[model samples]
Target: MRIQWIVSIVSNLVSMGLLVIVMGQYQVLNIQKQREEKLKTEVQRLANEYANDDLSKVTMEKLLADGNKTMTELEAAMAKLSPELEKKRKDVDACQAEKVRSFFQFPKIITLTRQCLFSIFYPIHTNMND
Candidate 1:
């Protein structure tokens, strides 16, 4: 009877050890599954962020293209009007020169009145005319 009792106790201890090992393996497998799920979620979030970045880049590229097109059109328009603008600028310069000559030839009273009116309306203070 004593031998039989010893044998039964040994068998129970062996079974308990096996159960502990199995439970440890199950816990490890559960932790691995949780880690895998976390990594998958992170990957999805990063994918969404990258997708938004790509959309922003595309929008910026389109805006840049439109801006460049507008700049080109403006440059072409300026080019077409450059000669006319230059001629007008030269005519204004010649008229201003004639006015300066006439102002010097005029009497002091007329010169002062013209200068005051020119100063009030045009506001260009050239040292030669001042």
Candidate 2:
């Protein structure tokens, strides 16, 4: 009679452990299902937001055409200004060359001015002595 009671107790304990394991597996599966459902809902919402509209498509094409037209106009304008830009660049270069030449001649100009002043004052002093 004692052996029979021990066997019954062991069987009950094993069944309870198996039940606990099954419950934990079920909770894990339920959590995974909820996550999958949430992801699916989010994906559907994104798809709706980005869905194509005919008016939007036409407007996008029109904008692209306008952008292309503007780019062509800008390129033509730049081409038309090329000669004028070259002329201006040459004029600037000539002005810079003239400035450099004047800078180099500055010392010579100063020496000439000093010689002229000495000549004018020395003659006046000599005539007064005479």
Candidate 3:
């Protein structure tokens, strides 16, 4: 009878330990399921936000077509005005060169003016008496 009582006590303890382990596993699985649900909700929200954006409404092909049209128009304008632009650039360069030449010739111009004034004031006497 004593042996039977000992065996019964050990069996009861083993059953309680298994029950505790099963409860722990159930709690872990419940937490994991909650985290997965939260991730799914976040993904859904991001997808909805992207779908509602203005850029998403415009198609890629349409955007490319508009860009190509603008580029072609700009190229045509540049081709039409290329010769005029080159002529204006040449005029600007000629003006700049003339400005530099005038600056360098300023001293020579003053010296020539002085020589002309002296020659006019001191005329050489052709008659020695008068």
Highest TM-score, which number?
1
Q: Residues 13-114, candidate 2, lDDT per residue (tens digit)?
A: 999999999999999999999999999999998777667555678889999999999999999999999999999999999999999999999999999999
Separately for all candidates shown, the number of backbone clashes (residues 3 or more apart, or on different chains) is 0, 0, 0
lDDT against the true structure, each candidate? 0.94, 0.95, 0.90
Off by over 4 Å in 2: 1-47, 51-59, 125-130
TM-score of 1: 0.65
> Taking the tens digit of each residue's C-alpha lDDT, what string does model 1 give over 36-57?
9999999999999999999999
Higher-ranked by TM-score: 1 or 2: 1
Predicted candidate 3 versus true structure: per-residue lDDT over 1-130, tens digit per residue: 9999999999989989999999999999999999999999999998888887645556766888899999999999999999999999999999999999999999999999999987876575434446
Clash pairs for candidate 2: none
TM-score of each: 0.65, 0.55, 0.49
> In model 1, which range of ten residues has the least summed lDDT?
120-129
Q: After superposition on all CA atoms, what RMSD does each candidate show versus the true structure?
A: 12.5, 7.5, 5.8
